[model samples]
Target: MQARYYTLNEARAALPVVKALMSQVQEARSEILRLRPEIWPVLQKAAHNGGNAAAGSVYSQFDKLETGVKGILKMGILVKDIDMGLIDFLSIRNGREVYLCWKHGEEDLSFWHDVNAGFGGRQPIDPEDF
Candidate 1:
């Protein structure tokens, strides 16, 4: 798929929708992690003995989590870290690809970094950069 490039303003404008989807992704991710431990044991028991009643619920959670994440990815937003709620929008800066970075709970997209530079290299977005 072709990469979608967002201008700073475009990225900002998309934030509300992105934020809502990210929240759903985070919740689904958390549910998967919480159910992970129980799921394995349930699977193991079912393999040796009989069907596990809880297994169905665990699989359902996994399906929902996968669907939620896929929905976000389909929007061209890279979900860097679901637990941390870090997402990046592909953008052009100085004629090169860069990431417009936002973390969970941030009021706006105020930082960006070179494509090669991860979150550790985030720099405050300069007004002129827009």
Candidate 2:
């Protein structure tokens, strides 16, 4: 499918929903991290025994993480990194397609980069330029 390119205003409008979904994703990720140490032992024990019941919580958090990411993608946003909560929206700038980038803690949509440039290449959004 073709990418959905957002106009500057449209990209701004999508931020709220993206932020909410990112929150959900981050929370689920935190839970997964907290539970990470326990999983290996449980799996090792279950290897000798039958299925382990103790892993349910960790698996459920994975489910939540997947669901939250899907919600963001359903809106046509690119999920760049789950742990960092980075996402990008396709946008047109100077007649070429670039990414309008946002990280989880950012207060507003104010950065963008070339299609090939990752976060390190981020440029500030000029008011007059989309």
Candidate 3:
């Protein structure tokens, strides 16, 4: 499938839904981490292609995480770090593709980075740039 790129307005328009989805992703991830000790054995078994009915809760959290991440990807947003709730919307800047960077808890999307820059290279968006 061709990659979906968002205009600045379009990306902003999608922010509310993105925030909700990220909340789900983060909540599921936190629960998964919290259950790590209890589910470690089940996880190890599953790595060996075995299933354990005893780890149903862990499995349910995995389902929720997968659903949330997939939901975001289906909208063409790149989820960079689920733990940190980092995401990027592909957008054009100066006629080149760049990422509009956003993280969980941010009320607005106000940063951008070159395609190769990653999160470390994020820069505040200039109002005139977008």
Candidate 4:
């Protein structure tokens, strides 16, 4: 998916939605964990019985939940891998965007990188450049 840059306000605007989606992910994770043991045998039997319809349903639900989480993260609400860093505002300029760092270890949003790049590839965001 293409990357979309969001200002501090825009990213913040998504907080409620992101939080809700995160909650859903957590719930789905819990459901999957709870069902694993009981459903494994059933899933195995279903897989062997027909075309794995039962197992496919469970997997599809898991995929949907995972996709939902990624969708929120794609919007710039940095929640995945909290150990990475906190990112506030996101700005795109000259084909790249910078994430305003706002975490315990970073002082500012001075770090940045290409849309497809990860934290390790972040370059310093020049304040004067917008």
Candidate 5:
């Protein structure tokens, strides 16, 4: 993970894709939460082993989808900056900060990392995954 900065236009151009990915992330989150009641105990059991095995699976999927979307957009995203995080735009639904991952390509915004980790660590997105 490296710090890849982005220009405003580059960030804006990828908005649609970012929005779509955000939608998936939200859906994954919703699904995780919806299933939490049934998942909690299993997750708790796994936590006993010092690992969030149960929840980790779901969370990994969520993170994958989230990162996948960010990667497609080729943006270095920080939902929040040195001061805040995604919480600031939580109410806006679809709002995300995709910083620049690279400077060019159809996959210009070819990767996305996390708010905490920033753009330096974007994982590739397989076209088939979309």
Candidate 6:
């Protein structure tokens, strides 16, 4: 699918919904990590011996994680890091695509960076630039 670009105002307006979704993504990610070790053992057991009953719960957690991530991507927002809760919105700046960078815990979307630059390259958004 073609990428969707958000105007500055639109990006800012979407923050609340984005924040909520990111929270779900973060929770799902943490649960997945916590279940990883258990999941592998269960899978190994199932491989050798018919099936492991515990595998269903582990797979359910993975399904939720995948669904949450797909929901975010479907909105045209990039999930940069689940642990960091970092996300970006595609936007146009100076006639080219850039990222409106945001991380969890921030009160607002106040930074942006070039397409090739990551979080370290973020610059404060100038009110006039929008």
Computed on alpha carbons, the lDDT of every model, listed in order, comes to 0.82, 0.88, 0.88, 0.57, 0.47, 0.82
Candidate 6 lDDT by residue in tens digits, 1-130: 2357988889889888888877777777777677778778767766646545456665676677677777778888898887898989999888888999999889999999999999999999986776
Best TM-score among the predictions, by candidate number: 2
Badly placed stretches (over 4 Å) of model 4 are 48-67, 70-96, 100-130
- lDDT tens digits, residue span 1-130, model 1: 2348889998899899888887777777777777778778778767646646566766677677677667667878788887898989999888889999999899999999999999999999996876
The ten-residue window of minimal lDDT in model 6 covers 45-54
Give candidates' CA RMSD values in order: 2.4, 2.1, 2.3, 6.4, 13.0, 2.2
Give a tens-digit lDDT track for model 2, residues 19-90.
998998999999989877878688677754654554787778889899999988988889998878999999
Order of candidate numbers by lDDT, starting with the best: 3, 2, 1, 6, 4, 5
lDDT of 4 by residue, 2-110 (tens): 4456764455466556556655666666667766876699876665565355466568669866776676667755553433323444666555555644332443344
The TM-scores, one per candidate, come to 0.84, 0.90, 0.89, 0.51, 0.43, 0.84
Candidate 6: lDDT of 9?
89
| Candidate 5 C-alpha lDDT tens digits along 98-128 | 3333322133444544445554565553333
Worst 10 residues of 3 by lDDT: 45-54
**Relative to the unseen true structure, what is the Cα RMSD of model 2?**
2.1
Error of 5 at 113 (Å): 21
For model 3, residues 1-130, the per-residue Cα lDDT tens digits are 2348998889899999999999999998998888888779877867647556546777888898998888889899999999899999999998899999999999999999999999999999986777
Which scores better on TM-score, 1 or 4? Answer: 1
Better of 3 and 4 by lDDT: 3
